[model samples]
Target: MKFLIDNWYLVLTAVISGGLLLWTSLRGKSAGVTTTEAVRLLNREKGVLIDVSEPEEFAQGHAVGARNVPLKLLSTGEPVKQLPTNKALPLVLMCKTGARAGRAAGMLRQQGYTQVVAVAGGLAAWREASLPVEKSAA
Candidate 1:
């Protein structure tokens, strides 16, 4: 007790950090892949990236070669309209932020997509990493 009292700041800091980690985990905000990792997956494993943003946001800007599949359509089992039929193929989901992509990843898994993951920071992270982005101009 004496040691704790002397180092109260350290103990409080440790407790707060542990609590934050626990809260994030309980909230289902677990980590995902980085832009570099996504690129590696794409180049080495032929992974497909699906943007879960609306068509308008997709047209605004997205990872180069990403397909727009909107979250609502995915929730309805639409498979992004042009998704490949192979369940074994890897599918990477992305959004403006990582939140929607996380939800879409769960839906894809429920739809029997064996390999699905969300980009850690979504398109914003991709852009921050200096990766190429494309637009539809529509």
Candidate 2:
């Protein structure tokens, strides 16, 4: 007891740091779609891939049939013109990294999209997995 009381500040800091680490790990596990799962969805289950990057980024290269919907529009809750009307379909969101996809997924869920998912590593991971990408028409 004497040692703990002598180093109270150190003990408190360690406790707080442990709690923060635990929270972050839990959060990551709860979100994100793996590349293998994404491929299965696209190939067998008819999943719709939505790229949330800017037009220029999307035009560079994207999942073969991905529809572009800028993160700006999604974050603001503006109606995306290109989204399919069928909300029952599984919609996969992607960005440069996985971060924006997660946010977009949340916004889409709030907008009444019941079946929404964010790609774990976004377009980069898809490419790394040797998936096909389609370039925009010049």
lDDT to native, each model: 0.87, 0.87
Q: Estimate, for each residue in 1-138, the C-alpha lDDT of model 1 and write its tens digit.
A: 999999999999999999999998875535578888788888899999889999999999999999888898888876555677998888888999988998988898998988888999899999999999988987
After superposition, the stretches of candidate 1 with alpha carbons farther than 4 Å from their true spots are 1-29, 78-80
- How do the predictions measure up, each by TM-score? 0.78, 0.77
Clashes of each: 0, 0
lDDT of 2 by residue, 1-138 (tens): 999999999999999999999999998865798989887777787888899999999998899888999989887777777887777778888888878889988888888888888889898998899988888986
Model 2 spans with C-alpha error above 4 angstroms: 1-25
Lowest summed lDDT window (length 10), candidate 2: 75-84
C-alpha RMSD by candidate, in order? 3.6, 3.4
